[model samples]
Target: MKIYETAGFPNPARIRMALAEKNASDAVTFVPVDVMAGEHRSEAFRAKNPDATVPYLELADGTCIAQCTAITEYIDGSFDGPSLTGRSPFARAHISMMNLRAENGLLNAVADYFHHATPGLGPDLETDQCAEWGEKRKAVATKTMSYLDGVLAESPYVAGDAFSVADITVFAGLAFADFAKVDIAEELTHLHAWRARVAERPSVAN
Candidate 1:
């Protein structure tokens, strides 16, 4: 399998982390796509993903998979080593629910702020309203993060005591927010500690 990746993008990082967690990193080839150069907008890439997004996966038979969540789940399902999803049925449901919450509450909000408020992808951002929207988004994201931090304080991971896909999904979005200069409150100490633990993984370094 071939994975089209970008160094600074959040979605690709999620898949990469999943690969590492499942011990499936060696089975795939990495292809870097330059987002700054607008390579993803090219005809060749659009053919692979009509959405024109990065973090594309090409199966060995030449089928393409887009979207980070789908790709991560596929990888986890295909591999046998340490499941990124929880071991039990209840754990799986919890992780899945938490993952969706993180995506909707944090990741998507950050994307809206980044694309519409900031000068994203080399395009000039809009007016003060955009910035206001961004502020709102940031607030929503931080509040959700604070709640997750409280949960993390009680449990070792976001979904439960086990490290699962919920942690990786949330981490990818949070790390991207850090790159974009979004600040988290100092009071969320549990989240800060959890971030450090996730960073210590080998996949995050790459």
Candidate 2:
């Protein structure tokens, strides 16, 4: 298998962390994509992934899987490690729900704010942008942070006691928020504490 990604990018960082958690970093080849140079918009790269997103997984037989969540699902399943996606039926659903919340409410929201409201990736990539919508999504990101803080206040992890992809998603979302200059209120202590603990995990710290 192969993964085409841009190094150090937020979404790609999620996949890298998953691979580390699975202890399967060597299981596939890492192909770097020059996203800043608009290589993802090129015909060659677009043929492999129509969405032209980074951190996509390519199977040996030539199947391409886009989206960080789906790629992380494949990694959690294929590798022998503590499950990141849940082992039980109910757990799976719960984790999935939480992951979606993190993705849409936090990660994608911050992304929209960065790409639209700010001078994200310069004029070349950000051809069309809506400042109003981006500002709205920024609000959504901040709200999601508070929601996650409340969730952490109750459960040990995002979904439950077990560490799962939902945790990973929220972690990445917070990272993106920091990069986008979004403020995480100090009152969200639970969220802050959880982030500190997660940062120490081998998948992230090492």
Candidate 3:
């Protein structure tokens, strides 16, 4: 397998952390995608992935998979390790629910704020922006942080007992929030503590 990605980006970091958790960081090749150069939007790249998104997975059979959720699902199933998406139907559904929340409420929200409100990727790449909508999304991101903090107050991980992809998504979401300069309220102690613990994990540390 090969992962076409832009290094240090949030979505790519999710795949990297997932591989590290499975102890398969070196199993696949990492192909760099120069997103800033608009390489991902080229006709050649679009032929393989219509979405033209970074951090896509390419199987040896020439099958290309886009979207972080789909790629993470493949990673969780292919590698031998604790499941990132739970095995049982209920467990998987629960994890998926929480994962979507983290992605939509936090990560995507932060991204909206960054690209719209802030001068993201500069004027060349960011052709369109709505500062008002971006500010609205920033509010959503903060609200989601508080919601997750409340969740962490009762649960050890984002979804439940064991660490799952929900936790990973939240970790990456928080990292993105930091880059976007979205202030996480100091009162969110549970969230802060949970993030600290997650940062110390072997997979994330790697």
Candidate 4:
């Protein structure tokens, strides 16, 4: 398998964490895609992913998988390791719900703020930015911190007691937040503690 991704990007980081958790990081070849240089938009790269996104995975037989969620699902299911998506029906549903919440509420919000409000990647890549909308999304991201903190206050993990893809989503989101300068409110004690715990995991710490 060939993994096309750029280091330090939030979505890519999520995939990396999943790979580490699955102990499959050494099984694939890592191909760096330079998003900042607009390499992902090139014809060669677009042929693999028309959406022109990184963190794409190409299976040995030539199947390409895009989107962090889909790629994570594929990785968790294909590899012979602990399942990050969950094993049972109820567990799967719960993890998916929390994962979506983290992705939509926190990750997407921070991404919008970065691409629309700030000079993300570069001007050439972010020509259609909307500062107004970005501001709104930034606020939404901030609001999500509180919601996640509340969730963490009740459970050890985002979905429940077990670490799942939802926790990975939130972890990556928080990492992106650091780059975007989106401060988590100091009052979000539970959230901070949860972050600390997740950071200590080998998958994230490295």
Candidate 5:
């Protein structure tokens, strides 16, 4: 299998982290896709992923998988280490719910604030509307963070005591949030501790 992604330190890092957890990184080839040079926007890249996104996976036979969620799910199901999603139906549903909530509620908002607002990334350099939208989206992100903090306080992981795929999804998103300078409240003690734990994991650090 081959994974095509940008060289820099965002979503690709998350995928790498996941692969490390599964002991699959050594098994797959890494293909660096340049985003800064608009290589992903090129016709060749689009042929692999119409969305022109990074962290795309190509199977050995030549099947391309787009989106982080889909790729992660595939890896989780295919590998035989620890099950990240879950072993039960209830666990799967709960993990999926938490993952979706984090992606839509927190991750997207953080991206709206950072990628859209920041000037370094193409479209952000062209206008102030992105900045304006970023500022507005920040409020929603704050609310989502607070909610997740509370959830983390009650449960060891995002879904429950067991570390699941939802934990990876949320962790990756929050890591992105950290890069964007979106601060989680100091009052979120549980979340702060949980973040520390996740960071300490070999997979995450790898």
Candidate 6:
């Protein structure tokens, strides 16, 4: 398998963390895609993923999988390591629910603020921005941080007592917030503590 990604980017980092957690890092070859250079928009690259997004996974037979969640699911399911999504039916459903919540409320909101409000990537890439909407989304992301803090206060991880993909989503969201200059309030102590613990994991630390 060949994984195309821009190293250090938040979405790509999520997939990378999943790969590391699954202990399947060696199962695929990492191909660096230069998003800053607009390589993703090229026809050749677009043929693989019409969405023109990075952190794409291509199977040995040429099947391409886009989106971080889908790629993470593939990694966790196909590998022979401890599952990152969940082992049981209830666990899987809960993890998926929390993962979607983190993605919609935090990760996507921060991304909107970055691409619409700020000079994300550059003027060439960030056209048709809406600062007003971006500001609203920024506020949404901030509120989500508080909500997540409360969630962490009740559980060891984002989904439940065990580490899962939902935690990965929240971790990536927080990292993206830093890049976008969005601050997590100091009052969100539980969230901060959760982040500190997650950071200690080998998958996240590396």
Tens-place lDDT per residue, model 3, 73-123, is: 999999998999999999999999999999999999999999999999898
Superposition error at 70 for model 2 (Å): 1.0
lDDT of each: 0.82, 0.94, 0.95, 0.93, 0.81, 0.93
Clashes of each: 0, 0, 0, 0, 0, 0
Q: Which stretches of candidate 4 lie over 4 Å from their true place?
A: none
- Give a tens-digit lDDT track for model 4, residues 80-127: 877899999999999999999999999999999999999987888998
- Give model 1 RMSD, 1 decimal: 2.4
Native-vs-model 2 lDDT? Answer: 0.94
- lDDT, residue 194, model 3: 100
The superposed Cα distance between candidate 1 and the true structure at residue 105, in angstroms, equals 1.3
* lDDT by residue for model 5 (21-102), tens: 8888888899988677778888998998999888899998889999887888898888879877778899888888998888
Q: What TM-scores do the predictions have?
A: 0.89, 0.98, 0.99, 0.98, 0.92, 0.98
RMSD of each: 2.4, 0.7, 0.6, 0.8, 1.9, 0.8
Off by over 4 Å in 5: 120-129
lDDT of 1: 0.82
Q: Model 2: how far is 44 from its true place, Å?
A: 0.9
- Provide the lDDT at 191 for model 4: 98
- lDDT tens digits, residues 133-157, model 6? 9999999999999999999999999
Clashing pairs in 2: none
Instruction: Kindly report the root-mean-square deviation of model 5 from the true structure over all alpha carbons.
Output: 1.9
Candidates 1 and 6 compared by lDDT, better number: 6
Model 1 stretches with alpha carbons more than 4 Å out? 124-129
Task: Supply the global lDDT for candidate 4.
Answer: 0.93
